[model samples]
Target: MKLTSYWLDTVPRFTGTPQAALPGQADAVIVGGGFSGLSAALRLRQLGASVVVLERDRVIGEASGRNGGHVNNGLAGSFTDACAKLGEDTATRLYKVLNSAVDTVETITRENGIDCDFTRCGKLKVGNRQAHEAALQTDYARLTVAADPEACLLDETQVREELGSDLFSSGLLYPKSARMHMGRFGIGLANAVLHAGGLIFENTPMTGMKRTGNSFEMTTPQGKILAKSVLMATGISRNAPAWFRQRIMPVGSFIVATEPMDEAAMRRIMPGGRNVVTMQNIHNYFRATADHRLIFGGRASFSRSRTTTDITSGNMLLAAMRRTLPELPDVKIDYCWGGDVDMTVDRLPHAGQWNGVFYTMGYSGHGTQMSVYMGQRMAEAMAGMPDTNPLAGRAWQKIPCYGLASHFLPLVGAFYRAKDFVQEMKE
Candidate 1:
C-alpha cells in the first residue's frame, strides 16, 4: 500500500500558469493555495481585483487533499445542541450558511465546468453506541422541524439496508450533503482563479507579514508581494504565523484507502454510495470512491507527523475497518496519509480580521463546504459588503495553553477514549 493521499496522487497538481513566475504586487494577496485561498482568489478576480495566491507546498496537498472527500453540510455538533449554545437565531443562521456552502460548491463546479465528479450523493450519519440512537433521533426531529426538511431518522430496518453492520441502532440521512474528488476540485478551482487573472505561486511560504501604510507587505521564501489587502487562509502548518498560533490548535487526522473492491462486495457494503460518518467524539468516516475503492479515515492519533505516527494510525484504521466489515477481511490496503486540521475551542468556524488581515478558518473537521462558501463571502466582505458574512463579527478565543503546541493532546485523547469506553460499557 502506498503511504500517500489517494486524492493528491491521482490528480494533476496545480502549479500556477504556464511559465509560473512570482509577481511583485497585487490588489489582494492570499496565503495558502488550498480550496479556501484559491476560491477566495477566484472570487476576487471576478470582482476585478488583481490577486495572487502563495503556497508552501504543492497546491491543496495538505488537509485539503488529505480529507475524506466529503462535502457534507451542517455543523460539527448536533443542531439541537448548537441551537442551545449559539442561540436559536444564531444557530439557525449558521446552519443556513453551511447549507449555502453546499450550493456555492455546486455553483462553482457548474459555472466553471469543473469535471471533478461532483455528486449530490447525500450523507449517512450513524450511531456508534445505543445512546447515539436517541441522539440521532433527537437531532433528526429538530432538523426536520426547522433546518433540514429532507433529513430523516432511520430505524433498525432502514439502518440494516443502508449499512452492512448491525452494530448501529439508528441513523440520520441528509440528502443535500454531497461528495467530490477534492484534489480535482482543488486543481480546477486553482485553474479557475488563473483563468480569472489571478497569479498563484507554489512552494512559496510566507515568512513574514506586516502592514505598511495602506498596504500589506508579505515576504516569502522566493519573493515578496505588496498588496492593498491580505487574506490569511494558511491553516495549521509548521510555519503558522505567530499571531494565529494562539487561536488555532493543530490536530492530527488520518486516512487509509483499501484496494479496489469487487463489484459484489461494493454493492453489498455501501450500495447507496453515501458518505458514512460515526456519531462519536472520536469518529470514523468512510466512503466509496468512484473507482470502487473504500476511503476510511478518522482521528486515530493525536500526533501530526506524516510518517511513523501516521502509519501507526493507518494500521488502527485498517483494524477498525476490518471489524466493521468482516466481508473485506482479505482486501489489500492501497493508500494511507495524514493531515492537520485546524480545530477551535468552540468547534465552530471563525471569520473576520485580527489586526489588518482578513481571514477565515477553524473548521474543526467540517471545512470542505464552509471553506468554499466563506471564501466567496469574505471576498464580498473585502469588496465592502460585510453583511455577506455571518461569521464576520464572531468572537475568536485562543485555546488556553495552546500557544503554538498542544502539549496536553495525549491527556485530551485519553479522556475522550475513556469516556467513550464508559459509554460503550453502559450500553
Candidate 2:
C-alpha cells in the first residue's frame, strides 16, 4: 500500500501560489516545512523579521502529514520522569508551556480562518491492563500535582462511556487538549505563513549550513541563503546539518487508517468522536477522522527507509485496535504508512542555541502542539527577549546520552523496544 494521508488528499493543496526563490540574505532562515518550520516562519514574520523557510519536500510531506492527527497535551514522558530528569521547578514550567501549546494551535487555526477541522474534543488516556491502570494512576497523581486542578481523572465506567470501548479500565482526561486534521493543518499553516509575508520554498533541500561571522549561510541545490539566525526544525532528515543530528534521533512510527465505517459502526466505537491513547509501553494512539474513519497508530521501527507495503506488521496494529474495540475486528485498513519522529533521549524536546544558531526540534511523538509553541518561542527569543520562556529554558540542558544515542539509534532502539516488551510482559 502506498502511504497516502487520507486527511491530506481530501483537502486541496496550496494551488495558485507563487513559488519562493532562495533569497541572497534573510534575517532568519528556517529549515523544514512541517508544523515547526512553517509556524516559526509565520511567527517570525509577525515579529517584523525577514524570514525564509526551505523544505526538502513539499510541505507536510512526511511525519507532519503521515501522523495519526491526535493533537493532545504534554510530552511523551510522564511528569514524574520529567521532574526527575529536569527537577520539579523546571518540569512544572515545561508542563505549563506544553499545556498552553494546545491552545496556541487552536488560536492560530481560528484566527487565520484555516479550515483544518480543528476540534477541542478532550483526549482519553486509556489503560487496558492492571499494570497499565496503575501507571495511569501514578501519572494522574503526578499531573494533578503539577497541572491545573481542573484536569481530572475518569473511572472505568466513565472511560467506557466516553470512548464506547470496554478495553480501557480507567482514563485520564485533559480538557485543554485537541485534535486537528494534521495534514490540512500543516498546509494551512504554510498558507498562513505566506499570507503573513514570509518566504517558503518547497522542494528546496538544505544541503549544508556554515556559520559566517554572526550569521549563517545555508546552501541548497538551486540556490543559497545567508541569514542572521537559523532555525533547524527538520525533525528526522539525516541530511540535516551535523549540529542538528547531534541532538535528535529519528524513530519510525507507523499508522493505519481503516476504511470509512458506517455511521452506526462508528457510533458504536467512539460515542463522541474523542481521541484516545492507550497506556501500553508500545502505546496506541487513535482518533475518528472527519470522514468517519478510525486513524489507528502505534508500533515503532528504527529503519529510515520508506516502505509502506508491509501488511504483516500492519496486522499487529489492527490486532491492537481490535483489543480496544472488538467491534472493529473486520474493519479493512484503507491506508497503511509510517514516518520517523525526532526523539530525544530523555523524551523532552530540546530548544536553545547551538553555537550561534538558534534551533528547536526533537518532540518525540508530541510535536503536533509543541512544534507551533516552540516556533513562537523562537520568534520571541530572536526579538531580543531572553528570559528562557516556560518551554525554552526548561529542557535546554541536553541529556548526557542524547548525542550518542541519536547517532547510533538503530542499535539502541532495539534495546528500548526490548525493554518495552519486557515491561509489557511483566504487566
Q: What is the C-alpha lDDT of each candidate?
A: 0.85, 0.77
Off by over 4 Å in 2: 15-20, 300-310, 393-427
**On residues 73-164, what C-alpha lDDT tens digit does candidate 2 reach at each position?**
76566666777777888878778887889989999999898888898887777776777677777877888877655566788888877777
Show the colliding residue pairs in model 1. none
Give the distance in Å from residue 251's predicted Cα in candidate 2 to where it truly belongs: 1.0
Q: In model 1, state the lDDT of residue 248.
A: 83
